[model samples]
Target: MPKGVYKLPEIKNEPIKSYAPGSPERQALKQKLVELSKGGLDVPMIIDGKEIRTGNLSDIRPPHDHQHLLGHYHQGDKTHVQMAIDAALKAKPAWEAMHWESRAAIFLKAAELIAGPYRYDFNAVTMTGQSKNAFQAEIDAVCELVDFYRFNVRNMYELYGMQPNSAPGIWNRTVWRPLEGFVFALTPFNFTSIAANLGGAPALMGNTVVWKPSKTAVYPAHLIMKVLKEAGLPDGVINLVYVGGKEAADVIFNHREFAGLHFTGSTGVFNGMWKTIAGNMDKYKSYPRIVGETGGKDYVFADVTADAKQVATALTRGAFEYQGQKCSAASRAYIPATLWDGVKKYMESDLKSIRMGVPEDFTNFVNAVIDEESFNKLAKAIDDAKKSPDAEVVMGGNCDKSKGYFIEPTVILAKKPDYITMREELFGPVLTVYIYDPEKLDETLDILDSSTDYALTGAIFSTDRVNIEKMTSRLTHTAGNFYINDKPTGAVVDQQPFGGGRASGTNDKAGSVFNLLRWVSPQTIKETFVPATDYMYPNFLED
Candidate 1:
C-alpha cells in the first residue's frame, strides 16, 4: 500500500437513488424538451420530415457507485445514421439559405438554457454518469458548455467582419461557410461538455450534425439533446445517436453525403478513421473535413525553484481529477534533484488528504473510474510500473472493484527519465515523478519533449523569465496547450484553446475561437464596380 505524509479527510458515503425515465426528474426533462421544442413533439430521429426509431435499446449506468441505473436510451444503428444524414441532407439547403443571425440565435438560446434550470440535470447526469465530483462536473457540463457556445458565437461574428481588400475597384471578402453535408460528432466519455461543443459548434455554423456520444456518457448526451430541443433548435439540426463505434464509423465513412468529422478520443481510433477517410476520398461527394483531439501524455514540470506545496496541490487535482481520465490529465512530472525529496514529501502528505468516494458526497475529491474495464487497465498499469526495473511505486497501487470501479490515487518515482511510466499515456490517477539535475534544464526539456508521442498539454514552474521564455519557445511543438506556473489540467474554455499536434490529433483547439474555424469553410466572394464578364482579368491582361 502507498503511504501518505498527511491524513486525508474521511469521506462520508451516501446512497443515491436510481434515476428512471418518466419519473419526476424525467418529467422535468420532458417538460424542458417540450419548452425547447416550442410544442413540437420530441422526435427521436428526424429524417426527411419523418420521425424514425431503430427500436434498439441500451442501459446507461452511473459510474460513481454503479448501483444506480441512469436510464435506457435508444441505441441507433447504421439505419439511424443514414436517417440522420438524410435529415441533415434535407435540412442543409434551407438552413444554409437562412440568414446567419437566425442560425446564431439557436445557439445563443442554447447557451442561455444551459445556464438556467437545465444546469441542474446537466450537472446531475455528469456527476452520476461520468463519476465527476460536483465542482468538476459543474465546470464541464455547465460552465464549459456555456463558454463554448458563447465564445464560438462571439468569435464567429468577428470572423464575419474580417475581410482583406484586393484592388481599388475590386474587393475580395472571405466568408466562412459550413460544409455542404452533415458533420459527424464522435465524442469521448471523459467530458460531457464535449458533446455540446462538438455538436453545437457545427449546428451553430449552419451545418446539421449526427452526434455519437460514448456509451458511458449516453444519458448526459441525451439530456444535452433535451436542452437543445428545449432551446428551440429546429428538427434535423442536431441528431443524437447512442450506438457502437463500428456501426457509426460504417455509416460515417461509407456515406457519400458525410461532409466532416469532429472527433475526440484515442489516437489509434483517430488514425484508423484517417485511413478510412483517406481510402474513401475518391468516393466522397465532397472533400470531407476531419478535426480530432486525441491522446495526451500531459505533464507538469517542477524545478528546484518551484513551490513544493503548490506543486503538490496541483498534482493532487491534475493527476486524480476525474480519476485522471481526461486527455489533459497530468500523467508525468519532472522534479529537479535538489527539490525531489521535499516535493515527494509534500506529495505524500497531500495524498493523505485526498478523499475518495462517490460523487454526490461533495467532500470526496476522487470518485470511481469510469467502469470495470478502466479500473482493470489502471490497476494493471500501476502493477506494471511497480514491476518495472527503473521505477518504484512510492504510493497507491491497489484496486477495490468489488464495490465499484475504484483505485487508490497512485504515484510512481522514476529512477530515470526514460522509465516506461514517464513514456506512456496512463489515463488514470497515476503520477510518475522523475528527478533530474536543475542545471541540465535544456536537456530536461528535450527529454520531456521526446518522452511521449502525444503533445496535448504540458506545464513548467520557474521564476526565471529567460528560462521560462526559452523553455516555452523550444517546447512549442511539445504540446498544443502549454502552461507556466500552473497545472496542465483544468483548462478554461474562453482563455485556453485545447487540442494538440502530432499523434495527439488535430491542432484545432477546442475552447476558444480556433475551434469554431473547424466547422466553417472559407469562401472568397469578389465584387467589382464594373461588370467584367470576360474570363481574363486586368491582372492577367497587359494594362
Candidate 2:
C-alpha cells in the first residue's frame, strides 16, 4: 500500500464536440459509422474476463433500418447468470481489499480512453444500434459518459475524505466499506451513459458486479466491456452477461450473497423487481440496496407570460429528440388558453422543418423508435386520439413501418385535462398538450401535479417572477428535477444530479455522491488512547 495521502485529478465536464458539416469530428464520425455499418460483430457473454458463447443467438438490427443487421449476441440462460454471480462473489474479497486509488485510476483511464481513442467508435455504435442522431449520440454516448466517469472519481475522493471529528482522548473514524456481497446492475437500452454508470458506479466503490445490459443495447454494451477490459479492470470484478431478464433475476435475487441492485428502466419492471427482492429477503444475508431511476411522464407547463416560441422550441426538442425514448422526455404539456394559438403556430412551423430518417444522415432531426413494440404503441395512441372527441391530432401523427419503425413527431391537442394521451407514458415521438384557463392558474397547477404517478422531471415557464415562485412552491413534490423557463430534458452531470421519487425511483440522484453512498456500508471505528479500570462513571461513584 502507498504511504502518502492521495488527491485525484481535477474533474471537469467533457466538452461536447459539435459534429457540424466539414468539421473533423464529423469526418471521423462518418468514417466510423461507415466502418461499423459494413459488418456485424459476434458478441459473447464476458465472465471472469473470458468470452463465453452459447449457440443460442439473437440478431442485433438497427432500429432505423430493420433489414440491416448490425451484429448477433450470444444469449445466455440461467446457468450463465449463475456463473456470473459466482465470478462476482469469488472476486469480491480481492477487489474490496484493493487500494481505493488503484480502482480510481482504472476508471479514470477508461474515461480517457473513451474521450480520446474510442470516442467516434462509441458514438457510431450508439447512433446506428440505438437509432440516435449524431448529436444525441455525442451527448449521451461520449460526453455524458466521459463526465460520469471523471465526476464519479472526484465524488469518490471527496466521499473518502469525509471523516468524523476526533475527541480529545479518542480517535474516531469511519470506513466506507463495500457491501458484503456483490452488486447486480440491470441497465436500460435508452442511454449508453446510464448503462455504464449503472455497473461502473458500484464497481468503482470496491464492489464486484454482475452486469446485465438490455438485449437491444448489447451492441454498444459489448464495446463498453471491451473498454473496461482494455483499461485494466480486473477479471471477475465486473462480469458482463447477456441473459434473459427473468432467468437473471431468478438467479440473482434468490442468491444468499446478493447485496445490492443498481437499475434504470420502466416503473412497472422496477416495481416487480422490488417485489421479488422483498419476497427473497429471508434468503439473503443482508437487505439488498435497491437504487433505480424509473419511468416519467415528464411535462412542460407554460404560463401566460411565457414566450410562445420558447415553449414551442422546448416541446419540439424535448419531445422529439431520441424519438422520445428518454425517461424524462416531455410527453405532456399544459399551455395557457391565452397563449395557445401562438404556441400552436410556432410548434407547427418547427415540426414542419424537421426531417425524419436514419441517423446516418447528418441533417435528419429525427429517427425511428427503438423497435416494433414502441412504434405500434405510438401508432395506437395516435389512432385513439383521432377517434376521441376529447383529443385532436394537431401536428405530426403519421406512422410508417414499411421501411423502418418510423413514427412522425406527433402533437395531440387535448380538450380535457384527463385525456388518455395526456396521462399515459407512450414512449415515442408523441407530445400531448392541454390548454387551460389562465384565470385558474392554481387549479391548472393542481391538474398538472396530479395527472400522472411519475415525479421525475418537469418544467415551468414564466416571465413573471412571482408566478414562477408560486408555481415552484405549489408543484414542489410534482417533480424531482424541476426546470425554470427552460425545457425539462438535457440534464447535465454535476450540474443536475438526476433521479426522482414516488413511482419514478428512490430519488437516489445519479452523477453525485448520493448515488455512490448507496453502494457502500460505512463502519464507524472508535479507539481510546487511555484505558479505564472501572465500568462505572465518576458521577455514579460520587452519588
Candidate 3:
C-alpha cells in the first residue's frame, strides 16, 4: 500500500450543455442521434465481462417513434440470472481485497469519459431510446451520471476518513468492509444516471453487483456497461442481464450470497421484493441492505400570496418534463381559489404554447411516455377524469398512439380535493389540480398530506414568510425532497441528497455519504499498547 494519504480530485457538478441550435454539442448530438437511430444494435447479456447471447431477442424501439426499430436486446432466463450470480461471487474475493483507492480511480475515470468524449453519445442514446428531449437527455444521461460518479468518489473518500477517537494507550480504527456477498441492482428506466448509480455505488464500495436494468431502458444501460469497462472496471464487477422480474428474483432472493438490493421503481414491486427477502431470511449469509426509491405522487402547493404565473411555469416544467416519468415529477397540486383563475389562465396559455412530438425535434417541449402500458394507464385516467362530475379536463387531454405512445401534457381540475386523479400516482404527463378555499388553508394542507401514500417530492410556493414557515412545518413529512418556490424535480447530486420515506422509499439519501454507507459493513478494531498480566485489581488485595 502507498504510505501517503491520497487526495481525490476537486469535486464539482458537471456543467450541463445547453444544446442550443448551431452549437457544437447540439450539432454533434444531432449527428449521433441520426447514427444511433439507424445503428440496429444487438445488445447481449454482459456476464463476467463477456457478452452472453441466448438468441431470445426482444425488439428495442423508441417511445416517440415505436414503429422505427432501433435494435434488439437478447432476453435471458433463470439460467442466465444464475450465471450472473456465479460470476459476481467469483469476482468478489479479488475485488473487495483490492486497495480502495484503486477502485475509486475507475469511477473517477468513468466520470471524465462521460464529461468528454462520451457526452454526445450518451445524450443521443437517451434521447432516441427513452424519448427525452435534447436538454433532458443532456441533464440526465451526461450531467447527472457524471455528477453521480465524481461526487460518489468524493463521498467514498470522506466515508473512509471517518474514524473513532483513540485513547492514550490504545488506537481505535474503523475498517469499512464491503458486504460479504453480491449486491443486486434493480434500476429504473426513466433516468440513465439512476441506472448507473444503482450499480456503481455498491461496486465503488468494493462489492460486485448483478445489475438488471428496466427493459425499457436497455439502450443507455448497455452504453453504461461499455463506459465502465473502458474505464477499467474488471469483468464481473457489475453484471448486466435482462430477464423476467420473477425469474431474476427467484434466483437472487433464494441465493445465500445476496448481500444487498439497490432499487428504483414502483412501490408495489419494492414491497413484494421486501416480502420475498424477509421470507428467505434464514437462507442468506448476511442480512441484505434493501435500498429503494419507489413511487411518487409528487405535488406543488401554492399559498394565496404566491405568484400565479411562477406556479404555472413550475407546473409546466415539473409535471410535463420527461413526459412526467420521473419519480419526482409533480403529479398533483393544491392551488388556493384566490389565485386559481390566474394560475389556470397562465397554465392554459403555457400548455397551449407547448409542443409534443419526437425527441429529435428540439423545439418539442414534451415527448412520448415510456411504452403502451404507461400510455393506456394515463389515457384511462384522463378519460375517467373527463367523465367524472368531480373533475374536468382543464387542458390537453389528448392521447395518440398511431405512431408512438404519446399523451399530451394533460391537466385535470378536481372540484373536490380527494378525487382519484389527485390521490393516485398517474405516472405520465398528467397533472391534477384541486382548487381549495383560501380561508381553509389548514384544511387543504391536511387533505394534501393525507390524500397520497407517497412522500417522495413536493414544492410549496408562498411570498409571505409566515405562511411559508407554516406550510413547511405542516407538510414536513409529505415529501422527503421538499422545495420552496421551485419545481420539486431536478435534484442535483451532493446538492440535494434525494430519497423519501413512506411508500416512496427507504430514505437512504442517494448522492451522499449516507447512501454509500449502506453498501459497507464496518468493523471496529481496537488495539491496546500494553498487555495485562494480572486478572485481579489492586483494590481486591487491599480490601
* Top lDDT prediction, candidate number: 3
Deviation (Å) of 279 in candidate 1: 0.7
Q: Cα RMSD for candidate 3?
A: 0.8
- When summed lDDT is taken over every stretch of 10 residues in candidate 1, the lowest stretch is 8-17
Off by over 4 Å in 1: 1-55, 532-543
Task: Determine the backbone clash count of candidate 1.
Answer: 5
Candidate 3 lowest-lDDT run of ten: 1-10
Candidate 1 to native Cα RMSD, angstroms: 10.1
What TM-score goes with each of the models?
0.88, 0.99, 0.99
Each candidate: RMSD: 10.1, 0.9, 0.8
- Per-residue lDDT for 251-274 in model 2, tens only? 999999999999999999999999
Error of 3 at 293 (Å): 0.3
Error of 2 at 483 (Å): 0.3
